[model samples]
Target: MRKLISESFFFCSFFSLFAAFSPMTIHAAVKVPVQQMGNKTVATAIGATRCLTPAMKSLHAQTVKQMEKDMAQVDAVVYAKAIETYQKKLSMIWSAMSEPYCGYGSRGMTAVKSSFNKSVNRMRAEFLAVTKTAPVAKK
Candidate 1:
Protein backbone atom coordinates (compact mmCIF):
# COMPACT_ATOMS: atom_id res chain seq x y z
CA MET A 1 0.00 0.00 0.00
CA ARG A 2 2.86 2.40 0.86
CA LYS A 3 4.63 1.63 -2.45
CA LEU A 4 1.40 2.27 -4.39
CA ILE A 5 0.97 5.61 -2.59
CA SER A 6 4.54 6.65 -3.45
CA GLU A 7 4.04 5.74 -7.15
CA SER A 8 0.81 7.70 -7.29
CA PHE A 9 2.47 10.72 -5.72
CA PHE A 10 5.32 10.50 -8.21
CA PHE A 11 2.88 10.35 -11.12
CA CYS A 12 0.95 13.36 -9.81
CA SER A 13 4.14 15.39 -9.47
CA PHE A 14 5.26 14.51 -12.99
CA PHE A 15 1.86 15.36 -14.46
CA SER A 16 1.79 18.69 -12.64
CA LEU A 17 5.20 19.64 -14.00
CA PHE A 18 4.13 18.73 -17.54
CA ALA A 19 0.96 20.77 -17.26
CA ALA A 20 2.89 23.77 -16.01
CA PHE A 21 5.14 23.68 -19.08
CA SER A 22 2.41 22.93 -21.60
CA PRO A 23 1.96 24.99 -24.77
CA MET A 24 -1.58 25.97 -23.82
CA THR A 25 -0.39 27.46 -20.56
CA ILE A 26 2.41 29.40 -22.29
CA HIS A 27 0.06 30.61 -25.05
CA ALA A 28 -2.41 32.03 -22.56
CA ALA A 29 0.28 34.36 -21.29
CA VAL A 30 0.48 36.15 -24.65
CA LYS A 31 -3.13 35.81 -25.71
CA VAL A 32 -4.50 38.76 -27.71
CA PRO A 33 -8.21 39.45 -27.85
CA VAL A 34 -9.97 39.33 -31.24
CA GLN A 35 -10.73 43.06 -31.13
CA GLN A 36 -7.09 43.84 -30.47
CA MET A 37 -6.11 41.49 -33.29
CA GLY A 38 -8.02 43.66 -35.78
CA ASN A 39 -6.34 46.77 -34.38
CA LYS A 40 -2.95 45.15 -34.80
CA THR A 41 -3.71 44.24 -38.42
CA VAL A 42 -4.78 47.81 -39.16
CA ALA A 43 -1.67 49.19 -37.49
CA THR A 44 0.51 46.78 -39.40
CA ALA A 45 -1.16 47.67 -42.69
CA ILE A 46 -0.71 51.39 -42.07
CA GLY A 47 2.89 50.87 -41.09
CA ALA A 48 3.48 48.76 -44.19
CA THR A 49 2.09 51.45 -46.49
CA ARG A 50 4.00 54.20 -44.71
CA CYS A 51 7.27 52.28 -45.00
CA LEU A 52 6.99 51.85 -48.77
CA THR A 53 9.86 53.39 -50.74
CA PRO A 54 9.43 55.87 -53.57
CA ALA A 55 9.97 53.02 -56.03
CA MET A 56 7.14 51.11 -54.42
CA LYS A 57 4.91 54.14 -54.62
CA SER A 58 5.73 54.52 -58.27
CA LEU A 59 4.85 50.90 -58.85
CA HIS A 60 1.56 51.43 -57.09
CA ALA A 61 0.89 54.44 -59.25
CA GLN A 62 1.56 52.38 -62.34
CA THR A 63 -0.79 49.69 -61.04
CA VAL A 64 -3.48 52.28 -60.48
CA LYS A 65 -2.96 53.59 -64.00
CA GLN A 66 -3.24 50.12 -65.40
CA MET A 67 -6.31 49.44 -63.30
CA GLU A 68 -7.91 52.56 -64.70
CA LYS A 69 -7.28 51.25 -68.19
CA ASP A 70 -8.79 47.91 -67.25
CA MET A 71 -11.81 49.69 -65.84
CA ALA A 72 -12.34 51.55 -69.10
CA GLN A 73 -12.50 48.18 -70.83
CA VAL A 74 -14.84 46.77 -68.13
CA ASP A 75 -12.43 44.03 -67.11
CA ALA A 76 -14.14 42.42 -64.12
CA VAL A 77 -11.75 39.44 -64.13
CA VAL A 78 -8.72 41.69 -63.84
CA TYR A 79 -10.19 43.51 -60.88
CA ALA A 80 -11.05 40.23 -59.19
CA LYS A 81 -7.56 38.84 -59.65
CA ALA A 82 -5.85 42.02 -58.51
CA ILE A 83 -7.91 42.33 -55.36
CA GLU A 84 -7.58 38.64 -54.52
CA THR A 85 -3.83 38.73 -54.96
CA TYR A 86 -3.52 41.90 -52.91
CA GLN A 87 -5.61 40.50 -50.08
CA LYS A 88 -3.70 37.22 -50.05
CA LYS A 89 -0.34 38.98 -49.92
CA LEU A 90 -1.47 41.33 -47.19
CA SER A 91 -2.97 38.49 -45.21
CA MET A 92 0.19 36.42 -45.56
CA ILE A 93 2.36 39.22 -44.24
CA TRP A 94 -0.06 39.96 -41.41
CA SER A 95 -0.31 36.28 -40.50
CA ALA A 96 3.44 35.85 -40.25
CA MET A 97 3.76 38.95 -38.13
CA SER A 98 0.83 37.97 -35.91
CA GLU A 99 1.56 34.27 -35.37
CA PRO A 100 3.27 34.85 -32.06
CA TYR A 101 0.29 36.69 -30.68
CA CYS A 102 -2.62 34.97 -32.41
CA GLY A 103 -0.99 31.53 -32.45
CA TYR A 104 -1.09 28.60 -34.89
CA GLY A 105 -4.46 27.47 -33.63
CA SER A 106 -7.57 27.49 -35.85
CA ARG A 107 -9.49 29.81 -33.53
CA GLY A 108 -6.70 32.37 -33.68
CA MET A 109 -6.47 32.19 -37.48
CA THR A 110 -10.25 32.60 -37.81
CA ALA A 111 -10.12 35.68 -35.63
CA VAL A 112 -7.34 37.19 -37.71
CA LYS A 113 -9.17 36.47 -40.96
CA SER A 114 -12.48 37.82 -39.67
CA SER A 115 -11.05 41.02 -38.28
CA PHE A 116 -8.78 41.53 -41.25
CA ASN A 117 -11.71 41.19 -43.65
CA LYS A 118 -13.58 43.93 -41.79
CA SER A 119 -10.60 46.29 -41.45
CA VAL A 120 -9.12 45.69 -44.88
CA ASN A 121 -12.28 46.29 -46.88
CA ARG A 122 -11.65 50.02 -46.46
CA MET A 123 -8.29 49.69 -48.13
CA ARG A 124 -9.87 47.77 -50.97
CA ALA A 125 -12.38 50.55 -51.48
CA GLU A 126 -9.58 53.13 -51.37
CA PHE A 127 -7.76 51.23 -54.07
CA LEU A 128 -10.85 51.31 -56.24
CA ALA A 129 -11.31 55.01 -55.53
CA VAL A 130 -7.72 55.79 -56.49
CA THR A 131 -8.03 53.91 -59.75
CA LYS A 132 -11.28 55.74 -60.55
CA THR A 133 -9.80 59.16 -59.81
CA ALA A 134 -6.49 58.61 -61.63
CA PRO A 135 -6.24 59.30 -65.36
CA VAL A 136 -5.81 56.28 -67.58
CA ALA A 137 -3.01 56.28 -70.10
CA LYS A 138 -4.03 55.82 -73.74
CA LYS A 139 -3.53 52.22 -74.86
Candidate 2:
Protein backbone atom coordinates (compact mmCIF):
# COMPACT_ATOMS: atom_id res chain seq x y z
CA MET A 1 0.00 0.00 0.00
CA ARG A 2 2.79 2.42 0.86
CA LYS A 3 4.65 1.76 -2.40
CA LEU A 4 1.45 2.20 -4.44
CA ILE A 5 0.69 5.54 -2.77
CA SER A 6 4.25 6.78 -3.32
CA GLU A 7 4.20 5.78 -6.97
CA SER A 8 0.83 7.43 -7.54
CA PHE A 9 2.02 10.69 -5.97
CA PHE A 10 5.19 10.68 -8.09
CA PHE A 11 3.24 10.07 -11.27
CA CYS A 12 0.78 12.84 -10.49
CA SER A 13 3.57 15.32 -9.86
CA PHE A 14 5.38 14.34 -13.02
CA PHE A 15 2.26 14.64 -15.14
CA SER A 16 1.37 17.99 -13.61
CA LEU A 17 4.86 19.30 -14.30
CA PHE A 18 4.67 18.04 -17.85
CA ALA A 19 1.37 19.79 -18.36
CA ALA A 20 2.73 23.04 -16.94
CA PHE A 21 5.70 22.91 -19.27
CA SER A 22 3.85 21.69 -22.32
CA PRO A 23 4.60 23.54 -25.59
CA MET A 24 1.22 22.79 -27.15
CA THR A 25 -0.85 24.90 -24.77
CA ILE A 26 0.91 28.22 -24.39
CA HIS A 27 -1.54 30.91 -23.28
CA ALA A 28 -1.32 34.38 -24.78
CA ALA A 29 -2.31 37.46 -22.79
CA VAL A 30 -4.04 39.26 -25.62
CA LYS A 31 -7.77 38.50 -25.86
CA VAL A 32 -8.96 41.55 -27.69
CA PRO A 33 -12.42 41.02 -29.20
CA VAL A 34 -11.95 43.83 -31.66
CA GLN A 35 -9.35 41.92 -33.64
CA GLN A 36 -11.84 39.31 -34.76
CA MET A 37 -14.50 41.93 -35.38
CA GLY A 38 -12.04 43.91 -37.43
CA ASN A 39 -11.34 40.84 -39.53
CA LYS A 40 -15.04 40.43 -40.22
CA THR A 41 -15.33 44.09 -41.08
CA VAL A 42 -12.41 43.89 -43.46
CA ALA A 43 -13.81 40.82 -45.16
CA THR A 44 -17.18 42.53 -45.60
CA ALA A 45 -15.53 45.64 -46.97
CA ILE A 46 -13.49 43.66 -49.48
CA GLY A 47 -16.60 41.76 -50.49
CA ALA A 48 -18.49 44.99 -50.92
CA THR A 49 -15.69 46.36 -53.03
CA ARG A 50 -15.83 43.33 -55.29
CA CYS A 51 -19.62 43.41 -55.48
CA LEU A 52 -19.79 47.14 -56.27
CA THR A 53 -17.49 47.12 -59.25
CA PRO A 54 -20.21 46.29 -61.75
CA ALA A 55 -22.56 48.83 -60.19
CA MET A 56 -19.83 51.44 -60.33
CA LYS A 57 -19.33 50.87 -64.02
CA SER A 58 -23.05 51.15 -64.63
CA LEU A 59 -23.20 54.39 -62.66
CA HIS A 60 -20.22 55.74 -64.51
CA ALA A 61 -21.89 55.10 -67.81
CA GLN A 62 -25.08 56.76 -66.60
CA THR A 63 -23.09 59.76 -65.36
CA VAL A 64 -21.30 60.06 -68.68
CA LYS A 65 -24.63 60.00 -70.46
CA GLN A 66 -25.99 62.72 -68.22
CA MET A 67 -22.82 64.73 -68.66
CA GLU A 68 -23.08 64.49 -72.39
CA LYS A 69 -26.70 65.59 -72.26
CA ASP A 70 -25.92 68.39 -69.80
CA MET A 71 -23.04 69.67 -71.90
CA ALA A 72 -25.48 70.49 -74.69
CA GLN A 73 -27.65 72.77 -72.53
CA VAL A 74 -25.34 73.97 -69.75
CA ASP A 75 -22.73 76.70 -69.74
CA ALA A 76 -19.05 75.83 -69.07
CA VAL A 77 -19.41 76.44 -65.32
CA VAL A 78 -22.41 74.12 -65.04
CA TYR A 79 -20.71 71.36 -67.04
CA ALA A 80 -17.58 71.74 -64.91
CA LYS A 81 -19.66 71.42 -61.74
CA ALA A 82 -21.27 68.20 -62.99
CA ILE A 83 -17.94 66.73 -63.98
CA GLU A 84 -16.42 67.68 -60.62
CA THR A 85 -19.23 65.94 -58.75
CA TYR A 86 -18.76 62.79 -60.83
CA GLN A 87 -15.01 62.83 -60.28
CA LYS A 88 -15.44 63.25 -56.54
CA LYS A 89 -17.78 60.27 -56.37
CA LEU A 90 -15.35 58.18 -58.43
CA SER A 91 -12.46 59.12 -56.14
CA MET A 92 -14.42 58.24 -53.05
CA ILE A 93 -15.30 54.80 -54.43
CA TRP A 94 -11.69 54.06 -55.30
CA SER A 95 -10.36 55.37 -52.00
CA ALA A 96 -12.78 53.22 -50.01
CA MET A 97 -10.74 50.04 -50.64
CA SER A 98 -7.29 51.65 -50.83
CA GLU A 99 -6.53 51.18 -47.14
CA PRO A 100 -8.00 47.73 -46.56
CA TYR A 101 -7.17 46.59 -43.03
CA CYS A 102 -8.07 42.93 -43.13
CA GLY A 103 -5.04 42.09 -41.05
CA TYR A 104 -5.59 44.93 -38.57
CA GLY A 105 -3.18 44.24 -35.68
CA SER A 106 -2.70 40.61 -36.56
CA ARG A 107 0.43 39.05 -38.03
CA GLY A 108 -2.40 37.55 -40.03
CA MET A 109 -3.30 34.04 -41.08
CA THR A 110 -0.82 33.11 -43.82
CA ALA A 111 -3.23 31.81 -46.44
CA VAL A 112 -5.73 34.59 -45.89
CA LYS A 113 -3.07 37.29 -45.96
CA SER A 114 -1.67 35.92 -49.20
CA SER A 115 -5.08 35.67 -50.85
CA PHE A 116 -6.18 39.11 -49.64
CA ASN A 117 -3.04 40.72 -50.95
CA LYS A 118 -3.46 39.00 -54.27
CA SER A 119 -7.06 40.15 -54.63
CA VAL A 120 -6.29 43.71 -53.57
CA ASN A 121 -3.28 43.99 -55.86
CA ARG A 122 -5.18 42.55 -58.79
CA MET A 123 -8.09 44.93 -58.30
CA ARG A 124 -5.82 47.89 -57.72
CA ALA A 125 -3.82 47.22 -60.85
CA GLU A 126 -7.02 46.77 -62.83
CA PHE A 127 -8.43 49.99 -61.48
CA LEU A 128 -5.23 51.81 -62.24
CA ALA A 129 -5.31 50.59 -65.81
CA VAL A 130 -8.96 51.54 -66.20
CA THR A 131 -8.44 55.02 -64.78
CA LYS A 132 -5.40 55.53 -66.96
CA THR A 133 -7.30 54.72 -70.10
CA ALA A 134 -10.67 56.24 -69.19
CA PRO A 135 -10.91 59.78 -70.53
CA VAL A 136 -11.44 62.48 -67.93
CA ALA A 137 -13.36 65.56 -69.09
CA LYS A 138 -11.61 68.88 -68.49
CA LYS A 139 -13.00 71.02 -65.71
Candidate 3:
Protein backbone atom coordinates (compact mmCIF):
# COMPACT_ATOMS: atom_id res chain seq x y z
CA MET A 1 0.00 0.00 0.00
CA ARG A 2 2.84 2.41 0.86
CA LYS A 3 4.64 1.68 -2.45
CA LEU A 4 1.43 2.31 -4.38
CA ILE A 5 0.96 5.60 -2.57
CA SER A 6 4.51 6.72 -3.38
CA GLU A 7 4.08 5.86 -7.07
CA SER A 8 0.83 7.84 -7.24
CA PHE A 9 2.48 10.81 -5.59
CA PHE A 10 5.34 10.73 -8.05
CA PHE A 11 2.90 10.54 -10.96
CA CYS A 12 0.98 13.51 -9.68
CA SER A 13 4.12 15.56 -9.16
CA PHE A 14 5.40 14.77 -12.65
CA PHE A 15 2.15 15.78 -14.26
CA SER A 16 1.93 18.93 -12.15
CA LEU A 17 5.40 20.00 -13.20
CA PHE A 18 4.67 19.26 -16.84
CA ALA A 19 1.46 21.25 -16.80
CA ALA A 20 3.12 24.23 -15.14
CA PHE A 21 5.70 24.55 -17.88
CA SER A 22 3.39 23.78 -20.78
CA PRO A 23 3.16 26.33 -23.58
CA MET A 24 -0.62 26.30 -23.49
CA THR A 25 -0.61 27.19 -19.81
CA ILE A 26 1.81 30.04 -20.41
CA HIS A 27 -0.26 31.30 -23.33
CA ALA A 28 -3.45 31.17 -21.29
CA ALA A 29 -1.83 33.19 -18.52
CA VAL A 30 -0.85 35.93 -20.97
CA LYS A 31 -4.00 35.82 -23.07
CA VAL A 32 -4.84 39.05 -24.84
CA PRO A 33 -8.28 40.14 -25.89
CA VAL A 34 -9.31 38.99 -29.38
CA GLN A 35 -10.24 42.48 -30.45
CA GLN A 36 -6.90 43.89 -29.38
CA MET A 37 -4.97 41.09 -31.05
CA GLY A 38 -6.87 41.49 -34.29
CA ASN A 39 -6.36 45.25 -34.33
CA LYS A 40 -2.65 44.85 -33.92
CA THR A 41 -2.65 42.39 -36.81
CA VAL A 42 -4.46 44.76 -39.15
CA ALA A 43 -2.46 47.74 -38.01
CA THR A 44 0.69 45.87 -38.71
CA ALA A 45 -0.51 44.76 -42.10
CA ILE A 46 -1.55 48.22 -43.36
CA GLY A 47 0.48 50.44 -41.09
CA ALA A 48 3.95 51.83 -41.75
CA THR A 49 6.87 49.64 -42.64
CA ARG A 50 8.27 49.73 -39.13
CA CYS A 51 5.14 48.16 -37.69
CA LEU A 52 4.85 45.33 -40.19
CA THR A 53 5.79 41.74 -39.41
CA PRO A 54 6.17 38.74 -41.70
CA ALA A 55 3.16 37.07 -40.13
CA MET A 56 0.98 40.08 -40.83
CA LYS A 57 2.22 40.27 -44.38
CA SER A 58 1.38 36.64 -44.97
CA LEU A 59 -2.03 37.07 -43.39
CA HIS A 60 -2.77 40.06 -45.60
CA ALA A 61 -1.93 38.10 -48.72
CA GLN A 62 -4.04 35.15 -47.62
CA THR A 63 -6.98 37.40 -46.82
CA VAL A 64 -6.86 39.05 -50.22
CA LYS A 65 -6.75 35.72 -51.97
CA GLN A 66 -9.64 34.35 -49.98
CA MET A 67 -11.75 37.45 -50.62
CA GLU A 68 -11.11 37.20 -54.33
CA LYS A 69 -12.11 33.54 -54.36
CA ASP A 70 -15.29 34.29 -52.48
CA MET A 71 -16.22 37.02 -54.93
CA ALA A 72 -15.57 34.87 -57.96
CA GLN A 73 -18.42 32.42 -57.41
CA VAL A 74 -21.28 34.76 -58.31
CA ASP A 75 -22.50 36.86 -61.26
CA ALA A 76 -20.85 40.22 -61.90
CA VAL A 77 -23.67 42.32 -60.52
CA VAL A 78 -24.13 40.00 -57.59
CA TYR A 79 -20.40 40.01 -56.94
CA ALA A 80 -20.31 43.82 -56.97
CA LYS A 81 -23.23 44.20 -54.55
CA ALA A 82 -21.99 41.46 -52.28
CA ILE A 83 -18.49 42.88 -52.24
CA GLU A 84 -19.85 46.30 -51.25
CA THR A 85 -21.78 44.83 -48.35
CA TYR A 86 -18.86 42.63 -47.31
CA GLN A 87 -16.52 45.59 -47.38
CA LYS A 88 -18.82 47.57 -45.13
CA LYS A 89 -18.77 44.81 -42.53
CA LEU A 90 -15.03 44.36 -42.95
CA SER A 91 -14.58 48.09 -42.40
CA MET A 92 -16.11 47.74 -38.98
CA ILE A 93 -13.73 44.92 -38.16
CA TRP A 94 -10.87 47.04 -39.48
CA SER A 95 -11.97 49.81 -37.13
CA ALA A 96 -11.88 47.34 -34.28
CA MET A 97 -8.40 46.26 -35.36
CA SER A 98 -7.13 49.84 -34.92
CA GLU A 99 -7.00 49.44 -31.14
CA PRO A 100 -3.62 49.13 -29.44
CA TYR A 101 -2.25 45.77 -28.38
CA CYS A 102 0.92 43.75 -28.23
CA GLY A 103 2.95 43.55 -31.43
CA TYR A 104 1.77 41.33 -34.26
CA GLY A 105 3.06 38.07 -32.88
CA SER A 106 1.74 34.64 -33.75
CA ARG A 107 -1.30 35.04 -31.53
CA GLY A 108 -2.22 38.43 -32.94
CA MET A 109 -1.78 37.19 -36.49
CA THR A 110 -3.93 34.17 -35.74
CA ALA A 111 -6.73 36.39 -34.53
CA VAL A 112 -6.52 38.51 -37.64
CA LYS A 113 -6.57 35.44 -39.81
CA SER A 114 -9.59 34.12 -37.98
CA SER A 115 -11.44 37.39 -38.44
CA PHE A 116 -10.67 37.46 -42.13
CA ASN A 117 -11.75 33.86 -42.57
CA LYS A 118 -15.05 34.52 -40.83
CA SER A 119 -15.66 37.56 -43.01
CA VAL A 120 -15.02 35.55 -46.14
CA ASN A 121 -17.30 32.77 -44.96
CA ARG A 122 -20.10 35.24 -44.31
CA MET A 123 -19.62 36.83 -47.71
CA ARG A 124 -19.72 33.45 -49.39
CA ALA A 125 -22.96 32.56 -47.63
CA GLU A 126 -24.55 35.80 -48.67
CA PHE A 127 -23.49 35.30 -52.26
CA LEU A 128 -24.93 31.79 -52.34
CA ALA A 129 -28.25 32.98 -50.94
CA VAL A 130 -28.53 35.83 -53.41
CA THR A 131 -27.65 33.67 -56.39
CA LYS A 132 -30.19 31.06 -55.39
CA THR A 133 -33.01 33.59 -55.25
CA ALA A 134 -31.92 35.82 -58.12
CA PRO A 135 -33.73 35.53 -61.41
CA VAL A 136 -31.78 33.38 -63.88
CA ALA A 137 -30.23 35.38 -66.72
CA LYS A 138 -31.39 34.04 -70.07
CA LYS A 139 -28.15 33.77 -72.00
lDDT of each: 0.53, 0.49, 0.62
Model 3 residue 14 CA deviation (Å) reads 75
Cα-lDDT of candidate 2: 0.49
In candidate 3, stretches whose alpha carbon ends up further than 4 angstroms from where it belongs are 1-52, 101-116, 136-139
* Tens-digit lDDT track of model 1 for 14-112: 999999989999978863533356447432331232223354345445545654554565345545655555556545544443334433245644555
Top-lDDT candidate index: 3
**How far out, in Å, is residue 2 in model 2?**
66
lDDT rank order: 3, 1, 2
Clash count, candidate 1:
0
Clash-forming residue pairs, model 1:
none
Candidate 3 C-alpha lDDT tens digits along 14-102: 99999999999997787443325644732233233222356655665675676567667666674577677766765554444554542
lDDT for each residue of candidate 2 in 8-126, tens digit (9 for 90 to 100):
99999999999877775554432323325643733232223232345445644664564455445445453454445545554554454335443323443453344444543454444
Q: Model 2, residue 9: what's the lDDT? A: 100
Candidate ranking under TM-score, highest first, comes to 3, 1, 2
List the candidate 2 regions with Cα displacement exceeding 4 Å: 1-48, 77-139
Q: What TM-score, to 2 decimals, does candidate 3 have?
A: 0.41
Model 2, residue 119: what's the lDDT? 49
